[model samples]
Target: MASVFLLLVCVGTLLGSAGAQEAYDRLPSKFKLGVDMALEMRNSRAGVKRLLLYFKGLGQSDIQPGNDVTYIYHNFYMKATQCPKGTVDTSNCPFRNIKPEIDCAICYKTIAGKIQASPKPYINCIRKPALTEAMKRKRVNYCNEMGYSSGAPGGLADIGDTYF
Candidate 1:
């Protein structure tokens, strides 16, 4: 009886841990072009910081320091567009729609491409303060041009506000 109780306890604990890990994995860990653009409009500084953290947390073998940003940018775009939407065929949508439910893929792709094309020579460029500042300015300008203001905090708040 003691051994059976111990086994059941261990099984329950393992199952709970697996469920928690799955929930975490379901959260966005890659920089999505549309999501980043929305966050930038809300708060450029926080947007870039979150993007940097996501990149840093990725598996080393998945992305290299010198990897082409354009490639990553493209991957993000593809992922956003490919994501299913309430049984709708979103692939035909002009803009890759994220939260707030709107089409704006053209703008997101253009800005993401430009950022990827820019030069970055500093070590761990994503972590460099100057680089982040520059990215913030660029993102802010892009958002402003599209008529979005810095009305809200970014990071988890932005995510919750937009999605939840």
Candidate 2:
């Protein structure tokens, strides 16, 4: 009886892992990068959550929902823009009634391993204390490989809005 229970546990663990990997495999390449970057940035939960959403949207996952902010925010916080560009499915989305994905800036960048500074429209747009400049640059490069840039397609991603 004990042997049978142990076997069941082992099989269950393997099945769970396979299911997670399968879900990850179904996400778009950019979303995949976002997941990696999120993990690297020490925010794996949010990143994995986002990836699961993608899988769910694609009919790949029965557990995770695939709606909310589609882009990976450099800050590790989910800043969802409302309708037209992003998903309006969430009830607590403060960005409600807005259009255009550009309205949300979810990217961080670095050139030569140095973080580029920019104008801040938000009153509380403060620097992320946890991430260093080099790490920020690396994340930006990861997102770039995922094919997201500012205001256009394929090219040097804008320093501010670059995400995937």
Candidate 3:
């Protein structure tokens, strides 16, 4: 009986991880575009002193219908890239060694299927003390899969550290 229970637990864990991976895999192209839009929108309003941020981890995403319009929502992590505003390209930028902010946005698309920035997608970001272990892992995974480097020079270690 104990052996059967252990087996079930392991199977359950595997399934859960697989589901999480699938979440990242879904809407890959759209996801990248959405992140870019979110960044651009946020940067447009940020002051000169504010450091630009980039995608760190994905939290949740969904597509739903509202009042005859289709809206897509994304909850993700963004970390300071230590890059200047209007840098344009930050593909090789290193993450700043500081607390990451959680950014959530709700976006709508036009009939042409392009994410509309006007009606200006609702976005908000808050700095957290630290990201959870799961969130940190997600960040590393996201960077790796996207072909971007992960973490900062003196930031938390790749695997063991819980906060980043």
Q: What TM-score fits each model?
A: 0.24, 0.32, 0.47
Question: What are the Cα lDDT values of the candidates?
Answer: 0.29, 0.33, 0.47
- Which prediction has the highest TM-score against the true structure? 3
The best candidate in terms of lDDT:
3
Error of 2 at 51 (Å): 17
Where does candidate 1 clash, by residue pair?
A: 95-105
lDDT of 3 by residue, 5-59 (tens): 9999767655644443344356455555666676666677746444455444544
Clashing pairs in 3: none
List the lowest-lDDT window of 10 residues for candidate 1. 52-61
CA lDDT for candidate 2 = 0.33
The true-versus-predicted C-alpha distance at residue 151 of model 3, in Å, is 42
